[model samples]
Target: MDFSDTIGVSAAGMNAQSTRLRIAAENLANKDTTATTHGGDPYRRKTVTFKEELNRQTGVSSVKVKEIGQDQTPFEQRYDPAHPAADAKGYVKMPNVNSMVEIMDTHEAQHSYEANLNTMQITRSMLTRTINLMK
Candidate 1:
């Protein structure tokens, strides 16, 4: 295995995790956003997907964000008669995002990002030591 391979692999993982975290944050931010303009629908939750791809030069399997897409799950309904966007039946359509779920996903994404960062740091230290030994 090449000494620089670890850095390259870890960087890819970090990038993917960063994207995941960004999407999770967006979902959380828009969790309660309702329609404002005419014919506008309430904010829908977004989801991130990851897929493995072979690096063209290194031939290593790397994780990449497959897509950032809308959540197909049904929107939530809440009884809010006073709300402007509320329906005639005293119900308002809410985003499908759940705060608890989003926070948990954020935590997982943060952990994954940290793991990749640690791998990069370790690889750098190893490379530094290897260079010192040659001097």
Candidate 2:
């Protein structure tokens, strides 16, 4: 494939991974957040979905962030009577965010972004060398 195609594909990958990282970060940041008002639900974990697309101009395959959605799992209940968001039964709703899972997802997104960056860099170098050779 040509350098332009490499750049286009890598750019798409980077964009998708960047969105993944953002969602993961949001989940991590709100892990401890409980319901603000009485008898309300706590923060739910957010998820990112990706899709593939064809770059018509470059004729390269690329990825895109398809959607951001909430986790369907039920909120965890903690027996904390004194909490502000506690229900009548003295139970508080806890955020569904899992720290370990979020951390792992963050790492994966970062690595994918890095890989795309590396590909773009390598393609740039190769293209530069080809141009120099032809001069």
Question: Could you say which candidate leads in lDDT?
Answer: 2
Clashing pairs in 1: none
Taking the tens digit of each residue's C-alpha lDDT, what string does model 2 give over 100-133?
A: 9999999999999999999999999999999999
**What lDDT score is found at residue 103 in candidate 2?**
96
Looking at candidate 1, the ten consecutive residues that score lowest on lDDT are 34-43
Candidate 1 per-residue lDDT over residues 10-125, each given as its tens digit = 99899998998888899888888987543346888888888998977877887888989988888888887788787768687788899999999989999999999998998899
**What is the TM-score (0 to 1) of candidate 2?**
0.95
Off by over 4 Å in 2: none
TM of each candidate vs. truth: 0.92, 0.95
| Candidate 2 lowest-lDDT run of ten | 53-62
lDDT of 2: 0.91
The numbered model that scores best in TM-score is: 2
